[model samples]
Structures are given as structure tokens and as C-alpha cells.
Target chain A: MNERSLSTTTRATVPIHRRATLWDRLLEPVLGVNACFIYVFLYMPIVVLIAFSFSASPFSAVWGGFSIDWYIQLFQDSEIARALRNTLIVASFSMLFATIIGTMTALALSKFQFRGRNAFETTLNLPIVIPDIVQGISLLMFLVLVVHLALGLPTIIIAHTVFNISYVAVIVRARLHGFDRRLEEAAMDLGATEWQTFWKITFPLIWPGILSGALLAFTLSLDEFVVTFFVTGPGATTLPIQVYSMVKRGVTPEINALATLMLVASILLVTLSILLQRRRSS
Target chain B: MEKQRERGQLALLLLPSTLWLGLFFLAPLGIILVISLVQRGGPVAWQLDGSAYVRLLDPLHLKIFLRSLTLAVLTTFVCLLVGYPLAYYIAQRPPRLRHLLHFFVLLPLWANSLVLTYAWMVLLRPEGFFDSLLHALGFAEPISLLYTPTAVVIGLVYWYLPFMVYPLYGSIEKFDFTLIEAAHDLGATRFQAFRKVLLPLTMPGVMAGSLLVFISALGTFVVPALLGGDKTLMWGNLIQQRFLSTPQDWPLGAALSLAMMLFMSVGIWFYFRVNRESA
Candidate 1:
């Protein structure tokens, strides 16, 4: 390590021209322009969507006086209300289950060197890599055929949890990587039991991870379409499914308003999660 | 006794989740594989038949598979082309500002894909923003970009760009800029230095991001449905139609799923092989 360090230090000390060459000068502005273009590409649709949401025009393209009518209309729509309720219910329950299960899995994987550890790890991670369409169909078949379970809200929750578990576990496990085991060991060496030590010490340390993971799960389940679409029965329409059906019908300003609101909610939650993770690390 | 108790505790901790995954997650995949092999006459009637795999060989189904593959490949390529420069630009930013920049990159990713697709629909459909803009710019006809394969690819590339950016950012963030300077000191051209040093170091990210985009793009359902419409049918739409709509062929759906899964497995195997060789 010191040998490599010596070479690096010497290299650092060497006098090298720090002036921008022609290529650097040429490339910097080009990269800047490209970055600006990419940002526009990323954000223009969202800006336009939000802009059109407040447009009084029924058509997305037609501009008219700004109004809150579409948002008010969304509130009056009974289908929208039902879909919102269903989405919240699914998100909350799925978040809770996924967080608990994933936290437990993360703790076990990080703390133990047990038999089947590799197998268990791989099994947990499989859902992340498996295509959502495949997972959706597979669960649909199993629920309908093998298990003969009803296609309803519960099935949707379970389907969402399938992917959510892996996501939460991965996030929590990443947070656990830098955890110090000695604190738990020391607590145990004292009068504290393993359970006591875990609750008082480890739980607080990993709480940020758990919170962010839960938030992520909640958002994912809320936005989940394909899997929920597969497993859902009639009258169990979540917001995405509702939105999808409405899109199939035709274009509407109400959808623009609804999409804008959903976008805001997701961005807020994701920002909160990021802040939580950052605060924990700092 | 204490060691045994500890072992038991470990088992207890792992059991519930392991069982949940095994029963609900792994079991469903197994069921799909088994269903793929069996023949389904109706909802109730079933018999073992391998003809589903053979039926996938027909020209129409094969075209669907090829179309999905082509779209996914195109999406991955376009994402890489668009994302790499952005990743590099962000990676070159000051360390203090990197997280904020990364947050911006991840913002859209965390947004619902459905909502984003709807936004794209607003932009690309007939008389939509894109068409209107083109018409204002002296285009004679309404631009029919939406409900086409190109629209599907655009939507996919947009959806998956952040996935590519994050991994490439991870790789580029850790890259030592001094190495490129050293190559420059040794009289190498800027392009040569980037090609020799930066590219090699970041290959892992490129491959990982490409695979992530490719797999998702291949299996995406909603984008094609909303953007590609009925004509630009992909493997995912075909499978969805088979299961949920006309002909309600479960075995065929399963077979198509298995075929996709098999292709993914091979891709993953090849990924690991390359990774190992590189290591």
C-alpha cells in the first residue's frame, strides 16, 4: 500500500501543465450544450404536462385561460376517489410488510454466515432482475391456478410485495454494510440481551434505511401498474389502472391534472427519502 | 447450548421471509415454467404438451419476439449514447454539488412511468405538442410520431435513461482523472487517452446499465400500449393479449414468458462470464 502511495504522491507532486488544451476547450462547451439538451429532453414533457393541466382547454394542445377546474373536477370524480383510496391502502400495507420482511432479511444476511446464505441472497435478489411482466403473469397463474386465490386487492398487495421485498432488502443491506458489529457485541457483553441491544442500538442506527426503504416501497406500490393490472379483479382499480383506462378512452385535461398531482407526490416522497439517507450518512 | 440457541435464532430470523419468497415468488416462477410445458384447452382442461414452444416458432410470434429484441436493443443503445455524456458531465462536477445533481437525475426515475408515458402521449400524439410545433415550423402535415415503433423507442429510452446514468455515474465518479492526465503527459491524444483508460475503467457500468435498460425495455408493457398503439405490437403486448384478452391462452403466455426468461438467463450468464474474465 505504501509503495503505491509513494508513486501516487510523486505523481501528484510532478509539475504538469494545467492549462486547458484545444480539445478540452472544444469539448467542454460541447458537453455543456449536450447536458443542457439532455435536461430539456428529461424535463420538457413534465413541464408541458403541468402547464397543460391548468389549461382551461379540453384538448392537451389547445391553450386557453388558466383555471383550477380540472383539479376540482378530479375531486368530484367518484372513480378517482375510489382509485386514490385503493392506491393508498395498497401502498401503506405493502410498505409495512415489505419493510418488516426486508429489514429482517437484511439483518440476517448481514449478521450471519449461515448455510444457504448465498442461495437465500440470490433468491431475494431474483425479483429485482426478473422482468415485471414475467412476475406479473407468474403470480397471476399461481394465484388463479395453483393456489386458487381470488384476484383482488390482496393479490395485488402480494404481487407488489414480491418486488418491493427485494428493493427494500437491497437498500437496507447496503446501509448495513458499514455497520459496526462491536457496539451490539459490547451491549450484549453488558447486561443487555440480544433483543434489548438490537432494539436500542441497531434499530436506531438503521432506522434511516428502513424509513427510506419503506417510502420507496410505498411509492413503488402506488405507481405499480403491470403487476397490479395482472392480479386485480373488478372494482379493485388503483390510480394507475384508473389512469390507464381513462387514457384508453381518450385524451382528457383531467388526466393531465391527475398526472401532475401524482408526479408532485412521488417527487416529494423521493426527495424526502434522499434527504433521510443523506442525513443518516452525514 | 448457547451456540445451538444462536443457530435457532438465526433460523427464526430467516425463516418467515425465506418462506414468503419461496412460496410466493419462486413458486410462481416454477408454476409458469410448468404451465409453459403443459397444454391448456380451457380454464379447467389441461394436459402436458411441448407444442407451445414449437408454436412460438411461427413467423408472426417470431416477429413479435424479434421486434421486442430490436426495440430493447435500440433503447439501450440510445440510452447509452444520451446518458454517458451526462454521467461524465455530472461526475466531473465538484464533489459538493454531485449529490444535488444526482438527485435531479433520479427525480424522473422515481416518478411513475405511467404518468411519464401520459406526458409523452400529450407531447407526441396527433395535434399534440410535437405535431403542433412541427406544423408551426412549416410542416404541411400532422406528424404521426405517436402510436409507432419510433415513439415506443423514444418512450423507452426516456424511461430508462436514468438507470443508465446512475450506473455510469457510479463508475465515472470513482474514476481517477490523473490517469488521463498521465496519458496526456505521455504524448497520447485526448481521444486515445479516453479510449484506452477511461473507457476500460467504465466498461462495467456501461454493460450493467445496458443490460438493465435492455431487459426492462424488452419486457415493458405500458409504453407500447400507450405510445405504440395496436400496430407496434411487442412481445409483452402479445403476452398480455394472450392472457388478458383474446384467445386467453395461459400456456402460450407462459411459454413466451419462459422464452424471455431463458434469453435473460443466457444474457446474465454471459454478463458474469465477461465480468469474471475482466477480473
Candidate 2:
């Protein structure tokens, strides 16, 4: 564990590996260049997409003078508007239901004793671990063939909530681990009811966790495509579904605009989620 | 009486999650199982028919399965190789820089994967970004990578690279850098130190990251659909087409889906076993 005392690479560079051969000297710079290359590889495509979204050209990679023509076209398309609205509806509703159920489950698992702990954990993980395509097809079969139910907004919402619950539960469970159980017991001991203790102590403490979970669920539901595509009926097109068809049909600058907006929204929300998680841990 | 009340409250708290998962999650999986066992043609759907599972044994279907497995394996291997140095670089940074670098590594994961794949579509398509760039540089036209297996592999690699980096960073950060110094004190060369101590110490991370990337790549639907086109049909695409396209072969799709679930369960089980042994 004494080696653990040196946490950074500065020691290796300055004093520790000073016996470094020429090859050793070269290794650090090589690693630095490789890191730069990987970051470029990751961001280059998205940068191109965002750049061309503002270009006047429909599908050309060449800069045909920067313009917001595609953004205007995106706004004017009624189909895109409807799809955005549907996506919001699915995300909002799923986030709500998933948050409540997942928060309750988190409390139950962490604050109370339970049997079948392994079984419960495995069941929750099943929705997350299984491939989306498989889960999508399974739900499609259940709704269409088994129950003869129609596929539409409700089906999409149900599928999203199923997966979202597990995500929300996991995040809240982590937050719970850092919390003191005695706070709640103390509140109850001071003549408060169980419900009162929860409202005053537990809820406020875990509210950040719940908010993070809700944000995550909303973000995930917004981009969900495979399950929504499989289980969806005609007329309920979400943003991702719209983008899928538009891209498959042919090149339109409208898709570039749409993709850019979704990317911005996702990046912002995800950053916030990560920040919240960091705050919780710290 | 107090104990009974506490138990009642626990049950109440868990009820909503249990009820929802049972109805929407487990029941649907059970439905898939039921669908896989039944016949496609008959009005009497209750009779058990092994035809769909048998159909998977066909050489054509087997070919697709094998190709998908190979592509997924390739993607995992390539991501591991490409992502390791960056992971190591990030692990070596000081605290603040380390945090910032981690954000960069995780940003791709938290962002929209669909748009990311579409970004690749823009670059890889015929007469698209790369072709135009090449022309601008006075080169020949048509990289012609679109609608090919290589394009599929590239897209998969781009999408799952962060998954590879994440687990690698976790394990590598905890590794003692002094091990390398100690090996050097014992007169091991730099390469020898890396080979003997560093790689072996980080084997758990390598395996974890590989499992994550492999499982995700195998089941990916979007990359293959958008980039693979008609030529490179993966299990995900095959299942999608069977259910969504004409002829509506639900039974075959269900069987294929179950098979995929089996593959994934095995991968995860192996992953947990490895972690346990290391712990």
C-alpha cells in the first residue's frame, strides 16, 4: 500500500523512473499522441454532423455557405413536430412512473430487511442485461400475439418504464449506501410517524438521487428506438423513430438539423446527470 | 406487533416495483418463451413444435450467426487494443486532470448513440463526407465503404469504444504503478515489466471490458441496420426483419431472441465469476 501513496505519474517522470532510457523517454509522448488520436476519432463524426447542419447544402459534405435553412425546414415539418411531441410524452410519463416505483424499491431494499435478496437483484438486472432488441421483440409478442393489444404510445411507455425502473433503482440504491439509517430512526423516535419521518428526513436526503434517476430515465426514453420501433403501431412516431425513417429514406439536411438538436439535448442532460452523481459521491 | 408492522411496510414499499416488473417485464419474457415453442401456421397454437429452433440449424441461418459472432468478437478485440493506451494515459493523470479526462471518456456513453451512428453514416456513405474530403485533397472518388461489413465493424467500434475504456480505467486506476518500479529494481526491462507484472495485474479489467463490449456488440441493432445495409445481417437485424417485415415470422424471431438471451446470460455469468475469483 506504500506504492499507493504515489497517486500520479509525476513521480515516475521526475524522480522515480529517472534511470529511463531513450525508449522510456519516448513512451510518454507516444501515449500522449495516442490519447489525442483516440479523442479525435471519437469526436470527429459528431463535429462534421453539427458543421453540415448549418450548411446550405442538402447532403453535400462541401461547405455551401453556412445557413440555418435546415433548421427552418425542421421546424416547418409537421411530422417532425408531432414526433417531438410524442417523444416528450413518452419520456415524461415513463420517467414519472419509473421514479416512484424505483425509489420505493430502493428504500425497501436498503432500509428494510428482506429475503430472496439475490433473486430480487437478478430480476432487476434482467431488464437491464438483456439486449434491447430481444426485450423489444418479447414485448411485441406479448402485446400483439398473446394479448391482441394494440401497439402505440402506451406500449412504448410501458416498455420504457420497465427498463427505467431498474436504472432508477440502481442509482438510488447507491445514494442510499452513503446515507445514515439512524436519521430516520431518530425522527421516528421523537414521536414522528413513519410517514412523517420519511417526509422530513429520508425524502430530502435522497431527493438528489431521485432527481438524477428521473433525468436518466427521461434521457434514455427519449432516444429509445429498437423497442419503440418493434412495439409501435402506426401514428406514434417518436423523434428517434422519425430520424430512423428519414435517414433510411435518403439524404435530407432536415435530419442533420434534427440530429444536432437531439445531440445537444442529450449532452446537456447527461452532463447534468454525471455532475449530480459526482456531487453525491463527493 | 411492531415487527409485523415493519414487515407490512416493507411489503408495501416493494409492491409497486414487483407488480410492474411482473406484469410488464417477466410476463413478456414468458410470452416470448411461449411463442418460441408453438407452431406458426396452425390455428391450434398450443401444440409444441420444434420447427423454429430447428430452422436455426439451417446452414444459412448458422452462417449469419457465425458471422455476427465473429464481427462482435473482432469489435471487442479491436476496442481493447485501441482503448488501452488511452485508458492507461488517463489513469496516470493527477486528480483534477483525471476527472476531466474521465468526463471526456464517459461523454460518448451518456450521449445519443443513434446520432453517433448516424454521424458515421454521413462520413462512410458514397459521395459523402470522406469522398468529398478525398476529392478536395485531389484523390480518387468513392471509398465505397458503405453497405459493407467493414463499415459495420467501424460503426460498432465507434459506439462501444467508451464501454471498453470505462472498465479498463476502473481496474487500471486501482493498480499499483510501483509494481513496475519494483520489477525494474529486480532488473526487468520496461517491456518485460509490462509483460510480467502490469498485464497480469490488469487481466481482470481486460476481461471485464471485453465482456461488456462483446455482449453489447453482439446485440446491437442500430449500427448494423444503418451501416450494415442488406449485406451484413446480424442476429439483431435478422430478428428485427422477421418480426417487422413481410411474412411476419414471430416464432423464428422469438426463438432467435431467446438464443441471444442465452448467449448474453452466459457472458454475464462468466463475467461475474471472473470478478469473484479476482476479488
Candidate 3:
């Protein structure tokens, strides 16, 4: 889900053949139409949700008159605010810890050939393919049976950091792979120590990756629900938890407003990540 | 002295994550394996036992497991069917438009699955967007599509199409179209060229995308919890129910978690094996 990972892969990509074959000419329009329909299928639900957020009446199937009443209600709701605050608290801390730890891991993997490198790489990737249920339930069981930590914000932070570290490492590792290492070599050859070389040459070059990784880590921590749901204690409900509870009651226009707001925030963060990706490549 | 200094720097670079993942990630999973083997007697006491995993053979639990598999398979194939063409289209576009289209495909993912599933509920509910549209198109009745197995599949596909598209596009973009051209130049039929050349070359991506989409859709909680009614329980919801809800069957839940992990390990191992073989 990290845009940096997706867009970075496009940097050195080759474009397709331009000369149209007769077969292509016959097939292209059909495929293009199907693609357009697929895009609509993907996006139509979201557009409807946003439009309905402005509905004057709650839970009405008909087009209720447009109004900002739901927005006003959303802002005034303290529980929602508390949940948002909790989400931010967890996301910020998770981002900070995951970034520092993950960037170091990425540096180690990229800069040195180590024993058990492949094993460590696979270990780090467990989060990517492993189900959230495993991560969440295992963490919960660990906290309860062994660590005896409260199922509160701290536990949530731990769970998020565990997964976020891998994502951050992957992003930073991708960046490290794409970056030129000769600059660091040049710095070291000029009588700079390894430490100085890293600070002067390596860190600056990979800083964008680190920043984007941090952003992705933050965004992922925000977006997570399953693991957070399991580990979160009472009084520490995150926004997704709050949304789930509200949704269980019924889909109110208030949730529509909240989903819209969160999505807009996601768009802005994604735009920032893509911008950071551009900066990294340039 | 230089070698020692380099070693120290490497240690500094590696120790934090090594310890963090070791203690937090690996250790917790290890603990789950242990917990799954133990019997929960009192609130705080557990005895070494292996019966919990046996309970995983319960018909209800087995049904959920099968349902999870069925939904995941459907989601993966549907995503591949839809996403392959989209990825192909994006890959064939001019560079500027390709980026824009790629950005759009990733946009829904960025918006998060929870929100999108909610949107799906809104659209699929009785007299909702789909129903209204169908009515306007001359259908006389409202059909409730939400809270069904079909709705669950739709939700999974909606959220996970990006996972399929990303890997597929990666492969498709790297493919050499000239080989296909050569096939045509040599008088191979279009179908023949596509089957022999393009499909074989892009097979890795297809497999990669399917596995990515499958693994995710298999373990998804949100899509099932909201869109899949109580009748349509899945592995994720089962795990949640056992741990967080009335059951609180820690051992059984842990066993289920371990089972899910086992499934993922096989998928991931296969995934790496595929990539390694292709490379």
C-alpha cells in the first residue's frame, strides 16, 4: 500500500511498443473500455459515500438535501475526538520507533554482507504476508500470559511497531538499493571515517527514503484495525475501533463525514509520499 | 583497529532492529506456539496440553476455515481477472498517463480498506446506490447485496485489487513485447503467441499477484466483519471471537493463529521460491 514502493519501481521502467499492430488495434479498445469500467467499479462506492455525507437526513436512502450538519455533529463528538487522539498517539510513537529501528536494519542489510542475512530478511518480511490475526492474537496472548502488559496504548504501539518496522525497512531498503553507493566510497576514499562518510554522503542520499518510510509507517499505523482491535484496552479506542462500533449500530451520515475526512487526509499523505519519491529519484 | 571500528558500526546499525524484532516479533510468535500447546485451567494458570489444537477440528471451526479459503480463492481470481487488464492498460499507456493511472489504482488502497468496505456497504445495501441505479435502469425491486458471501467477496476484491495490480504491472512492464511481435512476424496466431510467450513470461507476476492477493484476502478481518454477516464467519473473525469476545479461548485462538501462520508460511515460501526460480 506504500506509494513510494509502487512509484519507485517506475523510475527506470521501459515504455511499451508504440507502433500499433492490427491485432492490437482490434483489441485495444475493448480492453480500454473494460479498464474504464473497472476503474468506475473501484471508485463508484467511494464517490457515493462522499456525496451522501452531505445528506441533511440521517440514514435516508433518498437524496436528502445537502447540509453540513453531519460535519458539525462529528466535530462536537468527544468520543470521536478521543479516539482520533488515541490513534495519533499510537501512530506517532509507532512511526518514531519503527523508523529508527527499521532504517538501521536497512542500513545493515544494504551496507554489509552478514551471516544469516537471508533468514533475517525473511523474518522481517513475516509481517507482509502473515495475517493480522496471527500478529494480533499472538501479541495479545503474549501480553496477557507472559508480559502481563495492559491491553492499552502501549500494547497497541508494540504491535504496530512490530509490523511497521518491516514496512519501513522494505521502503528504506528499496531506497538504499536504488541509490548510488559510489558517493559513500568517494567520501571514504577522501580520508573520511565510515561514520563521517555515512553522515556526509550516505545519510543525505537516503534521508528521503527514511522520511518516506516514516510517513508510510505512520500511515500504516493509522490504517491498522485488526491488530489494534485485539490489543487495544478499554478507554483507548482508536478511530477505526470507533468507526466499527458506530457502523455496527448502522451507517449514519456522521460516519460518512468521518470516512471522507480520513480519506482526504490519506490523499494528502500519499501525495506527500509521491513527492518524496520524486525528490529521492531526482 | 579499522576492522574493529567497522564491526562496531555494523553492530550499532543492526542491534536495535535485531533486538526489537527478536524480542517483540519472533518471541511473541514463539509464545503463541507455546500457548497453543497449553491448557487453560484458571484465569491465571495454564498446564501443558495439546488438546486445544484438536478442537480446531471442530466442524464449525472447520467450516470457517473452509469459508475463508473459498472467499480468498474467489477474491484472488476475481482480482486477477479485473486487475490484470487494468495493470496491462496502465503499462501500455504513455508515461505521463501511466503514472496518473497507477496513482489512481493506488488511491483506493491509500484511503484504507475499512473506509472502502463501509462505502461498499452503503452501495450494496437495500435501496442503496446499486439498488437505486438498478431501479432507474428499469428493475422494479430493491435487492440487498450486503451481508452475504457475495458481498464479502466483493469487499475483498475492492480492497485487494491493488496488491494484485502492483506485482502484475511489475512483471508486465518488464516484459519484452518484441518477442510477441517476433511470434507474429513468424506467422504464429495471436492466441498462440499470447499462450506461448506472453503468458509464460508473465506467469511469475501472475503467480506473485495471486499469492499476494490470496494471502491478504485469506486473512482479512474488516471485509468479513462488516460485509460478511454473522453467518459468514472467517478465520479472522473466528480468531477475534475466540480472543476478544465471549469465548476468550486463548489456547484455541492461539492454535488458530498458529494454523493461519502455517498457511502464510507455505504461501510466502512458495512466493519466494517462485521469485528465486524466475530470477
TM-scores of all candidate predictions against the true structure: 0.94, 0.96, 0.91
Q: How well is each residue in A102-186 modelled by candidate 3, as lDDT tens digits? A: 9989988988887788998989988776788788877777787777888899989988999999999998998898878888888
Retained true contacts (fraction), each candidate: 0.61, 0.68, 0.57
Give the alpha-carbon lDDT of every model. Answer: 0.86, 0.87, 0.84
For model 3, name the residue pairs that clash. none
User: Which regions of candidate 2 fall more than 4 Å away from where they truly are?
Assistant: A1-19, A280-282, B42-44
Superposition error at B173 for model 1 (Å): 2.0
Flag the better candidate by TM-score, 1 or 3.
Answer: 1
Best by TM-score: 2
Q: Which runs in model 3 stand beyond 4 Å of their true positions?
A: A1-26, A57-62, A178-197, B40-45, B135-138, B273-279
lDDT of 1 by residue, B1-279 (tens): 988988888888887788888888999999888888887677425688887888888898988888999999999999999799889888776555667787788789989899999999999988888787777678878887999999999999899999999999999877777787688788777788889989999999998899888888888899999999988999988888878886777778888998888888888888888888887
Steric overlap count per candidate:
0, 0, 0
For residues A81-167, what per-residue lDDT tens digits would candidate 1 score against the true structure? Answer: 999999999999999999998998899889888877888888899998888888888898889888898888898988888788899
Model 1 interface Cα RMSD in Å:
4.7
Q: Native contacts recovered by candidate 1, as a share? A: 0.61
Chain B alone, model 3: TM-score?
Answer: 0.93
Clashing pairs in 1: none
What DockQ does candidate 3 score?
Answer: 0.51
